[model samples]
Target chain A: MTGPHGYSKDKDAHLKRLRRIEGQIRGLQRMVEEDVYCIDILTQVSASTKALQSFALQLLEEHLRHCVAHAVERGGPEVDAKVAEATAAIARLLRT
Target chain B: MTGPHGYSKDKDAHLKRLRRIEGQIRGLQRMVEEDVYCIDILTQVSASTKALQSFALQLLEEHLRHCVAHAVERGGPEVDAKVAEATAAIARLLRT
Candidate 1:
């Protein structure tokens, strides 16, 4: 695999955010298992959902900067395909 | 930027799937704008959510087979970090 370039520093920060989100999920699972208040569990679930949407958005932005931009510079249908794909992903994201 | 290797064929397929999902999202938007039945909108939204989850799972599996596995063969903390990141991403996906 080619080594990823261009965002190692920010990648680390993204990883840290993901780790915290991981912990939140675990806590959520325990909440469900323990039969915690339905509303309380739902609240945490909502927060986690938003957290994930935020992360996905961040990754999407980075993809545009790094992957899609590069593909466009090289020139071809690949660029249009990628932009369309990304737009679709964003549409999916907004639905949630 | 480096060209992506190992999944060009599948990548195209993924892009096509995303494009279809994009149309689905647009249809959902129209449904919302037209004030379609609440339950019907909710049902479509749920299907879209599952569709996104499926796409994410496919990408995650491919990443494990390609990226994470290659990083492991190369040897070092990079693999571990990647695996941790992937696990966290999976956790977030499940919460949804």
Candidate 2:
């Protein structure tokens, strides 16, 4: 909901990663279709989940380096808001 | 890889869920393309992660209900192997 977000500069790379993860999800579908072993499917799920966490971490790093830091430089309540937001995001990630 | 695996009976449902998740991944790509807020994107990532976990949970349920149960009924070392295999899978899921 914001323009030129922290990840905007790397949008293409982000899309590429998302697409690759999408492919992994499709691979999981195929594994199910072919009746692959349960453990094998579970392993793929974990891989996809791990890939997603990595993407989140990267986005978070950029957010802190850019958006959050920018908020701090602006010298207002925005910095607190950004830090709280990032913390919430991190908590959601950890729970997942 | 083994079939008819525990999930084979519900193959269609599993495939459908995975396709939905794939769509979510595509949605994430669109968000990045549109330069959505970093936190918003992170929220969606958590959602996708949660969905994957749900799918894994369902698969595990079927695995325990069918595969593990079958193994137990057969009354061999298979029961031990299946239980151990499932425990390992759960550990992996927890780590993710």
* The candidate that achieves the highest DockQ relative to the unseen native structure: 2
Give the per-residue lDDT digits (tens) of candidate 2, residues A32-60. 88888999999999999999999999999
TM-score of chain A of 1: 0.83
lDDT of 1 by residue, B1-96 (tens): 254843554988889889988988999999989999999998998888778877876675555445654565566677546655755675466455
What DockQ would candidate 2 receive versus the native complex? 0.85
Chain A vs native chain A, TM-score per candidate: 0.83, 0.95
i-RMSD values for every candidate model: 11.9, 1.1
Q: After superposition, how far is residue B20 of candidate 2 from its true place, in Å?
A: 0.7
Local error of candidate 2 at B6, Å?
2.1
Real contacts recovered, all predictions:
0.00, 0.96
Cα lDDT tens digits for candidate 1, A1-96? 264843454888899999999999999999999999999998999898888877875676455445554554565677556655754665466456
TM-score of chain A for candidate 2? 0.95
Off by over 4 Å in 1: A1-96, B1-7
Pairs that collide, model 2 = A1-B37
- lDDT (0 to 1) per candidate: 0.69, 0.92
Which candidate gets the maximum TM-score versus the true structure?
Answer: 2
